[model samples]
Target: MPDADRQDATLEWVERVATFCVEEWGLTPITGRILGLLMICDPPERSAGQIADAIHASRASLTSNMRLLTTIGLIRKVRVPGDRTAYYRIEDDAWEKVIQRKIAGLGAFGDIAEEGLALIDDANPARTERIRAAQHALTWLRDLAARHPRDATT
Candidate 1:
């Protein structure tokens, strides 16, 4: 594809990613756009101004999302030699971190289910079955993730 067409297609994909993040993860569309751009942008790192321009986002709006993404280990800030402007790039293990966080959340929900089970009365064991099911499902997922961890070489 021609360069301009490629860029247009890339932007469309970025918007799709933004929509997905908004619907599924409760993140702002702009946050997802930043992530998508970082994932596929040529040179792999971009200054804030370039990101803002490409995503059609205001610098002010990008700043907080950038900080949040950086804090959560999805992205990182770098300073090129002889260049004072900061650049951002997606972390090499960003997806793994995302999955790890999801697994941690599952573990937390399992703990909560355990507490609920403890509170249920012995006279009504059926009342605790739902909680037990939820706990079991979470435990199964966590175990599955452990059994088939991502290979670093990939």
Candidate 2:
């Protein structure tokens, strides 16, 4: 582990990441903290209690957040032999999986925009144009990511 001051600074940075996840991505603060902690915690795995103490979250909240993260395959719990406590670590490809899922979800928006375009009458092309623009954006994003899967990992 780093020295106390260094650790504190890192934790502060982690909290900023959690705040971004909460405000921009709609993730629970605790969940975001867990993700951020797993990414930087020394030794690469941490018990629930250790995580709770570091993030100033309760055990109960950590339990639920860990469960959700595990269910989504973002993190995993490992049991050490002769030890009862579960230690959690972020998946090696967690960000890749997350980005892939988001990309897949964006594809659905194209379908939605297509349906929206069908709803309006042909006489009002302006409305259809707006819907078309939305679909175009989604397609551009989807194609751009597909073209450069390597960049998406970063």
Candidate 3:
């Protein structure tokens, strides 16, 4: 494909990723765009101004989102010696961190379900069924994750 075609395709794919992040992960479109761009951008790192330009977002909006991503471990700030400009790059294990957080959330919900079960009186199956099902599903997923460990070198 020609360079222009490849660039267009890449932008389309990035938009798709942005949509997924918005609908599934509750992230802002700009945040998703930043992630999408960083994942495929050359050199694996870009400065704040460059990121803002690439995603068509304002520096004002990008600042908070960048801070949030950095705090959450999805991305990090890098400083080149003597440049005084802070660049951003996706973490090497960003996806793993995301998955780990999701699994932890599931486990938290399972604990909440357990508490709900304890609140039920007289061992009522009907009252406990929903909570039990939730707990069971979470446990199953946790077990599955444990059984199939991710390879360290991805």
Candidate 4:
């Protein structure tokens, strides 16, 4: 197969993955496309303009998404001397960190449950028991995450 055909195939796959991520994972298609492209592209790093062109997104959209990715530590920014433009690249353990953070966010929901439980009177046995059940379940999950580390693959 010719190199051009191969490149087209790869880009098509990336677009498909981006669509999947958007529809199933609640991420913007552009974010998924950026990640997909970076994962497969040679050099492993791309300037914002390159990513924008590859994903067919506006420069402003790429800037916004890149900021979000960088803030979440899924991607990192690189600066080469004498170059004004910033390049973005996926971190080695980006997916692992994403999973870990998601689990941690679940744990943080316990505080909301605790607040709700406090609002209910203890004398109301039925309502209190229901709230207690929810709190217990959430606590169990949080504790479970704490006990078991996030898997590298997911």
User: Largest TM-score belongs to which candidate?
Assistant: 1
- Indicate which candidate wins on lDDT: 1
- Candidate 3 local Cα displacement, residue 101, angstroms: 0.2
Q: Which ten residues in a row have the lowest lDDT in candidate 2?
A: 102-111
| Clashing pairs in model 1, backbone N/Cα/C closer than 3 A | none
TM-score sort, best first: 1, 3, 2, 4
What's model 3's lDDT at 38? Answer: 94
lDDT of each: 0.90, 0.89, 0.88, 0.83
lDDT per residue (tens digit) for residues 1-154 in model 3:
9999998998898899899999999999999999999999999999999999878899999999999999999999998899998999999999998887887788778878878878887567887787899988986766666676574212
TM-scores, one per candidate: 0.92, 0.90, 0.90, 0.77
Question: Which runs of model 4 end up more than 4 angstroms from their true locations?
Answer: 80-85, 121-133, 150-154
Off by over 4 Å in 1: 146-148, 151-154
Give, for candidate 1, the lowest lDDT window spanning 10 residues: 145-154
Superposed on all Cα atoms, model 1 deviates from the true structure by an RMSD in Å of 2.1
Comparing 2 and 4 on TM-score, the stronger one: 2
Better-scoring candidate (lDDT), 3 or 4: 3
Candidate 1 or 3, higher TM-score? 1
| lDDT for 142 (candidate 4) | 74
Clashing pairs in 3: none
Question: Between which residue pairs do clashes occur in model 2?
Answer: none
